[model samples]
Target: MGSSLFSIGLTGLNAAQAGLVTTSHNISNAGTAGYSRQSTVQSTNPGLFTGAGFFGEGTKVDTIKRAYNGFLTNQVLSAETKLNEYDTYSTEISQIDNMLADPAVGLTPAVASFFEGVQEVAANPSSVPARQSMISTAQSLVARFQNLSQRLNDVRAGVESQIKDTVTSIGTYAKEIAELNHKIAVAQQAGSAQPANDLLDTRDQLIKELNQLTRVSTTTATDGSMSVFIGTGQPLVVGTNATTLAAQSSRSDPSRNDVNIITQSGAAITIPENLLGGGKLGGLLAMRSSSLDTAQNQLGLIAVGMSTTFNAQHLLGQDLNGNPGTNFFTPPTVGVQRFSDASTASPQVDFADVSKLSGDDYKLTFTNTTGGYSLTRISDGASVTAANIGLSITPAATSTVGDSFMILPTRNAAANIGVSISDTRMVAAAAPIASAATSGNLGTASISAPVVSSTTDLASFGTAAAPLKLTYSSGNISGFPATLPVTYTPLSGSPITLAAPVASVPYSSGMSIAVGGVSFTLSGAMQDQDSFTLGPNAGGVSDSRNAVQLGNLQTTKTLLSANGSPSATFQSVYSQTVSAVGNKAREVKVNRDAQESLVNQATQAQQSVAGVNLDEEAANLIRYQQAYQAAGKVMNIASKLFDQVLALGQ
Candidate 1:
């Protein structure tokens, strides 16, 4: 009976000693990250039974268990991922917002100054200094556009670099996690009664760190190995194997960097950028695809609209040298990128109508050999035929079905915009034709300013078929020539002679006449022998009509949407772009803050469940020490009984 008591007491002592060691370990590692509080489980040993009654045995230590909640850990990881996503997005987009809103460094001041210079030129026509100032302002405006484009390109480059770094880091984490998974599976499968708590903690810590770089979903197997997936179930790690990620150029747009996973067989699988949600990498991809791309395209739209409209109107007037106006600003060209696998020839793309441009990219997919192609606007996913948007696609005879092309109307416009006319004297500011009454006119007949109503009129203005003369006789004009036939039609009556020269034609007040593609209106009573001259303006140094028209383009509704419903002026579009970026930045910042709070709450909850408490560990230490001393007292009592029995035998 004493020996059995001694054995039971030894069991109690061992159990108490184990409890003390576990409590000490928990107290020591309380501050360690990812460490879960561990405790030794105890169970009653098998009882010793006798005829009278069953005897109680000491307690036995079972296995140590870690205090971990999978659900809470997952919640914390999810919140952290979302917070990181918005944080990165906010940081990147704020750069663009600041650049666009800057007073001195922004495009607003440059646009205002350029138009102000145009106004000065209009006020002082033929002033060399004023024209030079206009040219200088135009050059400055062009430089501003180029600088902004370069900055945006730099941002793109930086995003690409970040993506590469992120991919490398993801690969590193995947490799490490895979290795840890193998180690854990081996340790867990060793059939040991002890749980590998430290290994599990280290693995969880790595997964949490990986989640911040990019969103990842983890699944644990029965063997204690975990698999990590990203971007809608694309495996990053499985068991002891990890798939590598590479930052490569996009298949459609070489300028863009995209993420792809390299398979074991060396096949690359592209992950759609939008599928990657929540993390720094996802945020960067979103900024590049949506925010930055839209801003740059809108800026390019403004540049194209201003340059094209201004140049078109400028060409309608004559310059200081009595020559027709040339282009005032350089026109931007359309961008076309053909797929590498496409067999069709690249189509010719141009801004057929500046007022119809939508500042969006289009995908042209040829469906059949019948010269049929479907056009899809990338921004809105609206579908139309190529001819619907004024795009002329000339497919090759060898073109096959499924051939694709990407057309960018305004993506590169701002960067490539330039000043076409360097010489200020070439700035057209005068009407092509001048209208006046002859010096010998005997009536109150007068002519308004001559307007070259068509390109045909402007082309024939100074040619041999021009300089038309008209003579009035008995309320009739008879000086019309055969080469330049005149169409005389009354304001409220039918035309008299629209063919060759007429011997006699009835003339009335407010009569309209068109000759050689030029139209003019004459008013008031005309006497016999009254005459008028319609010729090109020889010296139009004071003409500011075209300059005024050029300035008017600043407020003209020249930009149109793909469907031609929404339209805006140059300044209006720019203002909208600025407002959009600012609003997006504010929204992302708010979301980031909210998500950060959620992460903190989740983390606290997780810590509360699994965190070590020093006070509790200290109490456990005292309890286990008392238990060990009591078990020792029982053994001492047994020893005293044995000594008394032996002394009695002596």
Candidate 2:
């Protein structure tokens, strides 16, 4: 009886000691991150059975249990990853938002100022200072575009760097988690299938950290090791082995960085970027794809549109040097990124029509014979055949199926754009042709200045020495070249085309006439035998008609629209870019806030289940202390009883 009492008291003492040690451990590690509250699990030893009845033996500690609920933990992790994603996106896109939307630094004011200078030149075509100022403003505008493009390029480089850094961090965490998995597995296996509570907590913490960089999922094996996966179940860690994630140059565009995983056999597998979602890496990619790339393309589109339209008009005008104006701004070239090395050189991409340039990159894949190549609009995933996208894509000769290319029509236009001419005299401010009535006219009729829509026809019509003389006879204007086409539009009626330039049967006051490409307005009545002359505006120093036309281009809808029209202007496209970035920034900020709240709530929920509470641990400390003392007292009593039994034997 004494021996049994001593054994029971000793077991009670041992159980109480375990309880104290576990409670103390919880208190000590309360501030440690990822620590789950642990407690000793107690079980009474199987009751000793006798013929009469069963007798109670002693209590034993089953296992040290970690207070963790996988469901709640997973919920926290999910919310945390989403919150990180939004936070990263919000941070990254705000740079573009502030850069494009700010009134002082934005492209809108620069464009307005450039057109304002053009208006000054139009207002005084002969003013050297006005022309100089226009040139200066043009330079400033080009500088502004280049500056903005540089900023965007810098941001892109930073994003790529950050992606690499994030990948490296993820790889490091993967390796650490793999090591922890091995450690925990070995510990548990060596300990009667019991969990290594502290090691498990450490591993879980590593997973939580890894999730911040990229989303992750995990599974536990029967050997107590966790298998971690990311991006549609791509294994990051499996038992003692870890897969390393790396960032590499994109196959289609080398300037772009894409994420991939390195396998055990040293082969790299590129992860489809769309499937990799929910973390810092995902946010960076999302920002680039959704906003950054669009902003740069839009800016470059405006640059190309402005330069192309302005240059075309400038070419049509006569400069002060009596020469047809050259390009005011250099024409922009298209950018191409090839996928393979077997290229017969990427096809030169030029703008066939500036109005049809959509600012979206086109993918040209060589299927070898679907008319040599297929063009796809990257922005919308719509197939645009090479014939209709307003791009002159000359197919490559030795292009194999392994070769593909990305045609970025406007992506780098702004950076490469420049003012082509430096001399202010090169500014085209005069009309190419002039029209006037003969001095001997006897009628109150006057002819408007001739607009030479086609310089070729203007060159063919006449020279300033001998103009095309039109005589008003009865009701017809004659002396036009018979080979050229002539059309007349009455003020209140539709245009009527004469069957042949020689057969002008009718004429009226307030009528518009087009002879070949030259057009003029005839207002008021012309008496019999009154005459007008159309010829080149040679030495017309004050001719500002073309300058006026150039000024009018400021408000022209020259930028491309989705419906295949020049529907957007330079200022409006920049405004659209600003507005898009602003709206997206606001959206990301809102999502970041909402997701952050969710993260907090989820963390609190999970913490409530597994978090160590100091006050509760304090209560346990005293409770276990008392139980230890009571157990000691029982053991001391049993010892005394045993001593008395031993004395009796003595």
List the global CA lDDT of all models.
0.83, 0.87
Worst 10 residues of 2 by lDDT: 340-349
Report the C-alpha lDDT of model 2 over 527-628, residue by residue, as the tens digit: 899999887788756788888989998888987656666788888888888898999999999999999899889989999989999999989989988988
CA-RMSD of model 1 = 3.8
Q: What's the CA error at residue 13 for candidate 1, in Å?
A: 2.8
Question: On residues 458-575, what C-alpha lDDT tens digit does candidate 1 reach at each position?
Answer: 5444542456677888778776545556777787998765666456567888888877756788889899888887777776899786677677777778777545543787878888
Best by lDDT: 2
* Inter-residue clash pairs, candidate 1: none
TM-score for each predicted model, relative to the true structure? 0.89, 0.97
TM-score leader? 2
Which residue pairs in candidate 2 have backbone atoms (N, alpha carbon, C) closer than 3 angstroms, thus clashing? none
Q: Candidate 1: how many backbone clashes?
A: 0
